[model samples]
Target: MFTIAVDFDGTIAYHDWGKTPQFVPGALETLTLWNQQPNIQLVLNTMRSGKYLEEAIWFLETHGIKFVGYNQNPTQQKWTSSPKVYANLYIDDASLGCPVTKPDIFTPGGRPYVDWAKVDQLVSEMVLFVEPIHQD
Candidate 1:
């Protein structure tokens, strides 16, 4: 299965920088669906460390988002000691060409966030959803 590395702050959740970030609208639902799929794997990719990392993990756990790895992948190290997580796609609010919502005061860190609605539509168009065969 292919892997998708998702960012916590600003991507799935709001970008509070230091404080705990809130979940972006529709993010929990979308990620939950992705996690349930059989052909996909998820990895949490973020810059947060120490207690901050724990908080992010706890947030996802509370939200019921299952993931395959965190920060770096175990298999990636066997090939090369790269400090990067191996993923077919990287979803970040800062990614160029990525759709995002307009910055507003209510947003965390007072910054814009990834427009999940648009991202969802784009992802749907990109990935062909094949019906799985049921075994008797």
Candidate 2:
């Protein structure tokens, strides 16, 4: 199985971010499919906290995307005490190495965001994806 960390703002929704979040095309549908994959675990990793966090969470619920954990790996503590969340992949608009496009590429009002089409293709290529559990 693969553990994936996903951001809430521009990755899932549009650049509206803190205010009314507008979803990027195919974001919700892709997440919903990932959630149902038994060999994958989705973790909600984001900078959101307080009220802003609540709004993001609510948005996900309305879209039916379930996550295994939020901001932490539910099963990683058994192997490490580190606070950093361990994930096989991280889907975030602001991720340093992720492919992105300027606001101009998106619809007139769109802002810089992860190119989810590429993301979806990459995620699908790992058909045999798995992670070995380390033991002390």
Candidate 3:
């Protein structure tokens, strides 16, 4: 099983985060599907703190997303946070110059703001095609 570290602001929801963050279309559905899978776990890894993270959790729950965990505090230099064992994957839009270095990280853009369906489709397609590189 693997924990998917998904960003809250831009990945799960749109970049325009507010008191009530609007989820990107299909994001909830994707998370819900991932949650039901026995070999996959969803983790809310975001910069949001305190009540904000709680609110995000509530929102996810409202949309029937049962995540394995949430991380409001991430290591400063290291992008990931302190958590228990095992491998993980991250889904975020702020990954600057990613796929260029790690070509599998960046996904193809769909129809800008109105095409998360295509974006999600592209991500799944990329994941299927990209060979997993083991890190020791």
Q: Quote each prediction's TM-score.
A: 0.86, 0.83, 0.63
Select the stronger candidate by TM-score from 1 and 2.
Answer: 1
Which lDDT values do the candidates have, in the order given?
0.78, 0.76, 0.58
Tens-digit lDDT track of model 3 for 1-136: 5556777765677555454767666677666666666766666777888888888888888878886667732222265554632235666656552221111223223212323454445445555532222112
Residues 1-136, candidate 2: write the lDDT tens digits. Answer: 7889999777888777446777777687677777777888888898888888778888888878888777789899899998888998988888788767677654534667777767777777664542212112
- Local accuracy of candidate 1 as per-residue lDDT tens digits, 14-34: 877767668888788788777
> Which residue pairs overlap in candidate 2's backbone?
14-22
Off by over 4 Å in 1: 130-136
**Residue pairs in collision within model 1:** none
By TM-score, the best candidate is 1
Deviation of model 3 at 119, angstroms: 5.5
Instruction: Give Cα distance to truth, residue 99, candidate 2, Å.
Output: 2.0
